[model samples]
Target: MADIKPYTIAIDEERLNDLKTRLSLAKFPDELDEAGWDMGSPLADVKRFVKYWQESYDWRKAEAELNSVPHFVTDIQCDGFEPLAIHFIHVRSKVKGAIPLLFMHGWPGHFQEVLKVLKPLTEDGDGVNYPAFDIVAPSLPNFGFSEGPKKRGFASEQYAETMNKLMLKLGYKEYVTQGGDWGCHISRALAHLYPQYCKATHLNFNSANPPSYFTNPILALQHAILPYTSREQRGVGRSKWFDEQGRGYNSEQCTKPQTLGYALADSPVALLAWIYEKLHDWTDSYPWTEEEVCTWISIYWFSTAGPAASVRIYYETTQNVDGRKNKLDHQGLRAWSPGVKLGFSHFPMDIQVQPSTWVRTLGNVVFEKEHESGGHFATWERPDDIITDVREMFGKGGGAFGVVKDATGYAS
Candidate 1:
């Protein structure tokens, strides 16, 4: 492990200006009379966001806010393969007895989502109470300031292993993990691979299962009727929908991320639209009233990480698509793979998928919760609720294996 160094946020005005020029000159595809997001990201929506980003978004302000928090960069070698450096922010709680919590964000999301909660979490009564935690939010390898993985083996499973090594390198023998989107998978993978190091794992989505002797009837039914049901089956249904409508980006990334790399890597607005559209759609909230979403876009814009970071997912997951000799299984991700156990706090409004019994059959679910509010971006949309749930689930002295029974009599 190399010594951690303090990090700062600095923006390149010239690059941003160039990005604005490109957005101004972008040749948009013509929309059919009935055309809309059903085919892909709505052009009107992207245009509105781009207009706001160019006109009103303040990158320096967002940068200043980010700079207020302490950040560090360090390298950790996984099993002595080679050292991989990572960038992370550490918001130490002033409150006594704060537990260390590691928050992970997924694709189309950077550390910005978690940063929204830092101030409230660290302060009490207008001052530092530093309640309950020293939060560490790192840009996963190949995302943000963290260097992209050197080799082709940096899958989510490998990411889990790297994160465990990172925690150990930081001297956190045991710590709580919280994630949403892809972070959920990586966190669960961490738990699956290093249960001893991960004290507890919490997720916005639960998608994997342990090997099972018998098929779960309920899950089987859900899987069988998913296409006809009003409720969307996460991962699968979403992937299908995306493949039909929203997957152009994924297809491009998976097949030719390098080709689009120049545009995303160089153009800030392109990067913003590439990432922002997902943030808009994934959350329960959409058509983010300009001010609401631009703050997030500004972070990427100023940091100039829009394109480079966006491609990390492509770099990471492309192999899974290309290397498979057989047709890719679109219905579900491979279960029984070594990774974290997903815990879902199913929200009523969003498309929710229960953890298949297949998952429970293989591994133990140490903690689970069902909250009444919030969607994909839990931390940003409902920080207090998310923080409360996190504290309750991972609180010190909270043992693993606590049974969580939902009102429906579901033991999740």
Candidate 2:
């Protein structure tokens, strides 16, 4: 195995300057007199983001902040398969005998989302509190700093296997896994393929169950009746609706990501508007003063990872769905993990899916929770509540057992 090394930011100042010049020269599409985001990112919003990126956004500062975390890159030999190299940040806990935990991120999101939780998890001596655990946040292969996969057939299942290799390379015998969106699917696969290593799995979204079961009469009746009767169920349904409306980006990414990638990959402002729009729509309805949303966009814009990251969804989903039916078959699922145990921390302001029916059919759900506050970006939106839930779920006397392991015959 090749030794892993610390990665340094090496972006070219000239390239950044070129990006600004292109943005300044862009010829935008025409819109109606009262045009707005109903079509997509409004011209005004894109202009604001471009101005900020050109005049105010500091790539070096953001790079320094990201570098503050301890990060490493390692190469793994996958037997006969091509070698896969992985990049990850390890945040150590001040608490003695801390457990190891692996956190994953989904599409349109990255390792930055978890930094809020990472701070409290790794530090001590302040009011911050959490179960002591070594935290590992990796840029999913082909996403951020992680090297792009060498093979063409890379999917969520492949991502799971790669992550499993990553854990084994790091000498973790067992660990807990948590994720949302694509991360949720990959974590579920990790649990299914390597149950011995995956002591427990937790998810934010619970969409892993087979589609056939969703149409089953009993489940259908439960889905229909439950929403009317249960407040949580109703919230889940509403959340689903909101997600569908806000998910235009997903549809585009899953289908024609490469076409759109040309623009996003080249222009920082374009990438900012593309990602920032989702952050605004999905986060808690609280008014995000302009600075806050731009701050998040600045991270991705400066990283120069916007297009590479977006195309991953196209690669994964296109491999799974093709141009055929929406329903996923068992064989198709076997390519990924089958299902996962789910947990929820419902914030009063954020809409969430109910755990009862969702988890029982999905996987072995060992924990379900309801918190007073927080939203989609739990770590960033409400770090304390997220910390509390994570502690309660994975701590001693917690809902699940042992740490997660890898299925590819690798160490935990």
In terms of TM-score, the best-performing candidate is: 2
lDDT of 1 by residue, 238-337 (tens): 5355446655666777677778878776665567667766776566653357766776665555443344555656555546655533212221244332
Task: Candidate 2: give the clashing pairs.
Answer: 172-412, 175-403, 175-404, 189-337, 197-404, 197-405, 198-404, 198-405, 199-403, 199-404
lDDT of 2 at 302: 48
Q: What TM-score does each of the candidates earn?
A: 0.77, 0.82
Q: Give lDDT per model, in order.
A: 0.60, 0.62
Q: Which stretches of candidate 2 lie over 4 Å from their true place?
A: 77-84, 124-130, 208-230, 286-295, 298-306, 318-342, 347-355, 371-373, 401-412
| lDDT (10s digit) by residue, model 2, range 1-412 | 3386776655688966776687677666666788865566777877766677667766677677778878777775543456755667876666655666788987667777778888766564221223566788888876666666544556655677788777767666677787776676677667666655666766665453422343445655575565443546556675676676666666777777677878777766667777767666656664665665655665455443445464665555555546333223224432333334445555533434544554455555567776554556666777787777777776556665333332221111
Overall local distance difference test of candidate 2: 0.62
